[model samples]
Target: MGAISVKSKHLLGLKGMDRQDIADILDRAAYWERQPKVSDALRGKFVANTFFENSTRTRFSFEMAEKRLGAEVLNFSAAESSVQKGESIYDTMRTLESIGIDAAVIRLKPTGVLEELAGKLNVALVNAGDGNNEHPTQALLDLYTMRKHFGEIKGLTVSIIGDIKHSRVARSNLWGLTAMGANVAFCAPDTMQAPELEHYAPFVTMDEALQADIVMMLRVQLERHDKGLIRSAEDYREQYGLTAERAARMKPHAIIMHPAPVNRGVEIDDELVECGRSKIFTQMEHGVPIRMAVIERVLTS
Candidate 1:
């Protein structure tokens, strides 16, 4: 647990941020990762969890971070709120604020719903995920994980594979990988790939992407899409999925990563996940500290 020694507004992205902002946050997070010192930096702060979708990882990680920082957390979902009863989402945002919350960490089913709620709330707005658009904090954690592993980020080749169009992780990773000066690459089937994000990445094929310093995989959200997005999980497993053979093609020291709840054989082979080069488990550990950093920076400085 750590305290928020200073107060500040929320940080939604790297946009408009000078290089200093990125360095300080990363430095402080790296410091906290080592010390784990508990402080009342956020004493008396109140944060509300208004997730409109299912998320055990993000919600619980934030709750843990807030609590460790001495903030009170209020948790609930749209199904249990007025939004499910046909009330507007902004109205729901107002209702959450009505409870005198200090910050609102939201994850909604619709894309850009966070931006919609941002205008209406006086409290800080933390976007956990907004449809397939963005998950800023997730991106931050991923960067933190990368930084921890290599100690520097610039010019590092990182490939993220699998269902890009539907993955908030993919979108978030794109922003993060580019912001930190890492060379990013995306690979997937035509139907599942995100629109050419070459502006943010170097643009390489799966074979070429495998020559990365880092290799990450985004989960295939099978339940969310229509039939056309994927022909078959087995077919997908054959082509885009990271198999043991593909792992052999990767850089000798390259680390594999994923944002968990892996489909085992769908997006990545189970063997690679347990391999020595894999950083997937380490990424999960990075979530708590990176989230704590995000909570501290966004809610209190």
Candidate 2:
């Protein structure tokens, strides 16, 4: 795929996006963070939150971002729409476009559909999440969090630990972090590993994973896996969870992160979720500004 133009209106994913484009969005996010809570930046525009999958954070975060920018918002749920009656995602999106939405923040269960929709749609398309493909805004907020803490992304080490085989967060983080010069690593059980991503980063042990500058835990997506991969929550936690003992061994400056709705004790210990070194909630706070920047950029640029 070609590099995304600076003026590219759609934020499909960060996989092949330009390094400078990522930096620009982060920089703009910092600016938005400093401004007042609301603005008329996107005034007179119509933005739709069209989700084909269930989401809490990403969906609400995009809605908050749109409202902050003063864009009129339309929230769409697959269950409440004609999608339940067998309408295609493409047709649903087209219907929104026909209704004069200037942009669409979409989350779908199928991969590659957003890319096809981006090519066919007249309005800007922002990827909220698409299967295990990518979640650009989540990655952007993550990068923003890291940059806010460490002051730069280059030379930092980020270890993403958990179900790599079914994580769009891990994939987006891998692409964006690598583009910004961070060394990325994956730590997961054999069955949870993504073979396709092995060439991009090394698969390390729990000890090696904890040694990185950033320790990101991914939610164990039990829904995507068969019954045998993980026998029980306790078993999975003992093997891969960021337990208190393991967190104690991490470097003094390393921070913890997760793209939530976290699995509490399954992927990370409950206490560590809000520990001093954890940036989980901070990541959520940054989501609004990062998404505001993305929405403003797509609509105004």
Candidate 3:
């Protein structure tokens, strides 16, 4: 809807967004896909990219999106910054603000940190990913990817597998997909499922999950191992990993997806990474323009 053009100054999460608002973003992203890839959409603007957590795709896709839009980018490295010396997140945001950064795309390990900072900041804020909270743009690009393939998101069945408890992608996708009329489900073990997601049914077995238009496998998130969420990679693969046998059982038209930094053998078989139905790489490619739409929308709003 016009809410994005009217009121959305920050993309903190997808929980509070309307269906039409979600549709608007996908529409805008589709529009951007056909236009020139490079533009001065954010010319003379300075955007800061701050990542407190390690990342490869999300961080770089954001950088590429900002550069493609012709915005001056300030890459904030937590390793070399005052944060390593105990500088608080608020202070770091203030530092960027004082220096006239027009917007910030941030990835942090703490949930709700972006919303807390959004209240105090003047520049536009884009939540690249937050701790098991939400990754709105990732969700947007996902919807775009599906729409590009199926001609629409409505009525399509989407099954998200793996560690839903710690996946911001799952949270984001649920909100975005369901809002656009898709039937969303989760396929994960009891420990891997999010108790908060009661509206959608989670299948405990892969057979039930494969009865969908899209099958998305999530990374195991080894960092959560210290918390005892998983035992070992072998143990995980044995229980819930997408093996070649399982992939073979999926519906003939069912496509595969993974939010990357994939542990190939642990989550999905290595060969399926580039399989005909796998949109894992295409999802990554969609990130740029979807983010371009987001950056333009937020900054101009």
User: What's the lDDT for all of these models?
Assistant: 0.77, 0.92, 0.87
Best by TM-score: 2
- Output the worst ten-in-a-row residue range by lDDT, candidate 2: 1-10
Candidate 2 runs further than 4 Å off: 1-5, 224-226
**234-255 per-residue lDDT for model 1 (tens digits):** 7777878889998898888899
* Higher-TM-score candidate of 1 and 2: 2
**Clash counts for the predictions, in order:** 5, 0, 1
- Candidates 1 and 3 compared: the better one by lDDT is 3
Model 1 lDDT-worst window of ten = 1-10
Give me the runs in candidate 3 sitting further than 4 Å from their true place. 1-6, 223-227
Of 1 and 2, the candidate ahead on lDDT is: 2
Worst lDDT run of 10 residues, candidate 3, spans: 1-10
Estimate TM-scores for all models: 0.92, 0.97, 0.95
Off by over 4 Å in 1: 1-8, 15-18, 224-226
Provide the global lDDT of candidate 1 against the true structure: 0.77
- Cα lDDT of model 2 by residue, 234-290, tens digit: 888999999999999999999999989899988999999999999999999999999
